[model samples]
Target: MPSKGVRVFTYIAVAGCSIELSVPKQTVVRNELNTFWNGDLEVDARNIDSLFNKKGRFSFKVLSNGRLVTEQWIDVNAITGNASGGTMDTIASTPSVFSPNNDNIIVTYGFYEAGQGHDVLPNQHQCYIAVAPNYANWQGKLAPPGSAQEGKPFNRLVLPSAHDVGMNSMQSSDSVLKKVGGAIATSLVGSHEAVAQITDSVSGPAISLVAPNIIFSLAITQKDSLDAMLQIGARYFEFRPAHCHKTILAAQALPDRLYFQHSAIPGMAYDQFLSDAVAFLLAHPAEIIVVQLRWDGVPAECARPSDQEQREYLDAALKQAQGQIVAGGLDDLRSSTIAQLRRNKKRLIMLVSVDSLSTYTDAGNATLNGDSIVAAFPKVLTAANERGKAFINIQCQATAANITEAVVYSVLDAGTTTSCIMATKAICDSKTLPWCRDNVLRTCDNNVLVVMMNDFIDGATADVAVQLSKQRLEQ
Candidate 1:
């Protein structure tokens, strides 16, 4: 974060939702800067008490390898030829003596005219910040009785410290001026109270910091550099961000409060997850589980299943269980998905997740390839309606697929050479299957299956399991 700068507010909200949220604005400041390195420097002074009225100026310059040379000063009122003669007791001029150790410039006071009592501030006010590395010198008359045009002074290398406290200050007041800049600003009387504003910009000299490519080298020595391993896609009958204990307690205590995790796509659509969620609800009979999808805040990418598919799932669930459906998050589904889910019953409650949906600002053009994804919503609803099944849209848009945590995929392993070839074919065929298109799959050995499989049969090969599931489904 910059040590000194202005902060602005930006509102980031759920895409397409009317809700507005405020986020902090921050800018990184460079540690190495050139503004103070060079001998050339310009200063603008202003009076705060009187509508921020008053003008003063000063200049300085430094040489390469830390050398100082040529300094100048100017009074503003003198240029106007006012009887005041730009005379201000507070004004002090220090010149001569090169190579000063001082790299910083601080102006505490401004010029004040006699009889004015520092009370009546001049109408003109100005402050500036400019940088030129040994390129140019200060401008304007050093002693007055001259024009504003002053040629560049001694310069060989190095630049002055870019930090312009005065510039930053004025910029500060300018921001406030903006909010009230128009008629309201005009209505408010400007105050003149010796307010000095400065805008400081600092940057460090270029130096080598740890580079990304050097991570492995650092890891060998830095014990703390190692990253922790996180298990992904573990089923959570009850789940929480940090722990599942609380959710587990709810499940145990309330039996009726069931929780299910469905694959979720953040920022876009969650119909797939939602479909499974609704199916789970229908199958659980009297259970209302909180259906959640680990949606990465991205857009949806799936073809709408045909009515026949929806009928099969919904009809199966209705025959076995009785429950309501809830849906939210536009990625979970836009507002329309709620209406679709509600068509089946009054029990269905549509709940939107705070972050499940986002607009263009998120994934940009990638969020919605065309209105095609958007167009699929109605088709899904139509399918649900035909089956006499209720739907629920849970609005929780999560964008987490960037990591391996979104899904826990087990590697299919084969036993005999014959089984290996069959497993390879089945896995290969699954890749082209619509349901597996976005999923990751790989073949492994029996050793891997021993560690990963929860329901391990002593002699079943990976191919056998696929075959078994297929046969069972057919039955």
Candidate 2:
């Protein structure tokens, strides 16, 4: 548990739990792509038994500037200070073979404990250890949709949208089970008495890693802040609302109201995002905004609302955002002209699901109990401009690999074909991103749009906003 201590450097990874160690020439970051950080150890082990002699469990602290980045707990009887794996090591995200000391060296990171030994990895959680690379900033922000695109019937214009817009900061209280599960596993670190607690928590994805723990979904999605997205030329906001948290028994949701979530996992508050959008739209009157609401992560009871209930609930929420959206429901909006909507100052538009059932609202501190039926799937659709309601079409359902690649380091740094930009190009070149491009130039002509976009952080998505806003479908 003791050596020259790991040197630190800049590091990045997709994770629900994150902690970094910084030293002059080396840096080590412990992050989970599909798991939570126990957040137990942040600093190196102190080689002192008293430091870890807690309730008969041996735990060590990993701190950054004296702040607890994370901790590690082990059975008190396992190590004998005599066990040592000796080899020089470098701190990086890529995997490396090194032994700090056999008795108690942190080997595997970002995984649930192996049944027989900690050295073995659990299939459910895997962390990519590599030399941390520096990523570049985005080229530039896109221009907002204006002048050249106005008079065209709303459907005649292509819309660029973001998918799963709220998957940031999962380790915070923002997510229901993520919080409880994280605390349960983290609190008992080094506590041999509570091994069962760790077992229960890491067993499921919701509590441990949101189950299914697909390779791409290991970390929260949507890297940009709300302000950053607004500044990035995103006129359309794609979100799924869910309950914030739920009770362990009966599985009932907590009353945190509606929150932006990627399925059962919560992100930000729906109202807070709405307020920010309203403020932005108010500041930019000429810009038309669309809020596409879908049901991918709603609770069981709310997922299938009877006929009028879902529609009514949405109508009520939209009505409350009076200044943000146009008056009346789809029936009233089915045929409005862009020129008319623009003139009326109807800048904010709602794009609710084709069916009601409250699409996303589960219990617990504003959960959006919905699903991630993927908004990236492609489909061919003819324009139906005169349909009246000013709305959009989102083609959800994407392959797990495609979605996974979008959230990795490839999204920001240049890498192989698996990077985000490459995945985006594959989709953009497909029938998806350009579904309406063939005819977006014609205003009021035939106004049906199957608008969809890829997941977040950087790459083609940002350009997508710029590309559509400029009416240049040159993918």
Candidate 3:
């Protein structure tokens, strides 16, 4: 896992005014009409009160190998004391000027006074845009109302999802291993001789220490943050919440002491995962996301909270992210359109287990149970599709085999050659979007709604989903 390096740049203007440009290191675009290249621009003019209510202009320019392709200017009034930012989705090229053969397409933007010239900003803020024969908006290109696919139900839409969405920061440390070992030791002490032998072994303490690292390595299924995942067009996220290690060891029923987990290993804190989801929803007005929460990886010795207690904990968390969740029962939401959800400003849908559906409902949040959604492993897609569920999740990662291989490598190679990332990439690449487009989508019936990928997910998967959506619209 080598670093991709930093790709952000900032420029300070006069009088405390500043502009920050954020774009992908490389964007793949198709040279066609109505195609867009998207980026983010943040403008700050609050430091100078004289600029309040004054007009400022944001200019976006695209050039292909030193030749101008397109330029757009947007005028805005500086708020009295607030920083303003928005997603810039501008046409990258027209059919007459751009083609698949073009290269070195640079996308750049700048902000200046309404009447200032384009030369006001420096030239260091440009990013390369790659030209390709096929392109799609990997972030968001939802089918709007009145389109042919507008009336399509949730089950028919091809939504990209992240498997183990919270495992972006899995770590292997002494503190983490201790908690994991404690959980395993508590669960299988009497039933398994190996567990007792490992606990009683003093001469082989290193074996006990290294065992958890093997588990942690295979537990990680994602490496990108939730914000980055959303930016690349992941519309569904699966979060598994388990008791924090300390709370589990103490045998306490603390509702708030939870972390997102992959089996026994914890990744991101539960509160932080929720906050990130809320922020993304607030920033993207036209996008809709589905969140599925499962109670997993709790040790046998820990005291599980009552359903009412779980409800109270989740209700408090949802309050912090209020107004973004879609409010309706399972039946109503299943039939609703993407446009309908966005127009109502309710863009998030939460799916819980049957036992917790009432818990979420009592809190006045829109919630559904397993009946409306079906999550299947890659091997069981055909069977799962037969259920005719409204939202079918095809988790493409093979967890058991991946963990077994990781454990075997750790033992044979002394943990030197074993890598969670390499294993995940091998599996994900085998089932990439292009592969899925032909083997899964084309072969499976119309029940495949969400295609969830494992670690190293990027815009390429979103590009396929966008293309599929467009094809559906045309049909």
Q: Put down candidate 1 lDDT per residue, 1-475, tens digits, no spaces.
A: 1111111111111121111111122112211221111111111122212334343332222232333322232333312311122222211221112223343221111211212111111112211111111111111112111222111110100111110001111221222233323221111111201100000111111101111101111011100000000001111111111111232223332122111111110011123223444554454322122222232221122123344543453344344334444332222222222123234332222322223211112231111112322333233323223232112121011111111111000001101111111111111121112111111122111111101111001011112223222222222
- lDDT at 34 for candidate 2? 23
Which candidate's lDDT is highest?
3
Candidate order by lDDT, decreasing, is 3, 2, 1
Steric clashes per prediction? 74, 74, 0
lDDT of 3 by residue, 373-400 (tens): 1222233455443354545544444333
Report the error of model 1 at residue 198, Å.
50
Candidates 1 and 3: which is better by lDDT?
A: 3
**C-alpha RMSD of each candidate structure in angstroms:** 33.0, 15.2, 17.2
Task: Give model 3's clash tally.
Answer: 0
- Give TM per candidate: 0.16, 0.46, 0.56
Give the TM-score comparing model 2 with the true structure, all chains together. 0.46
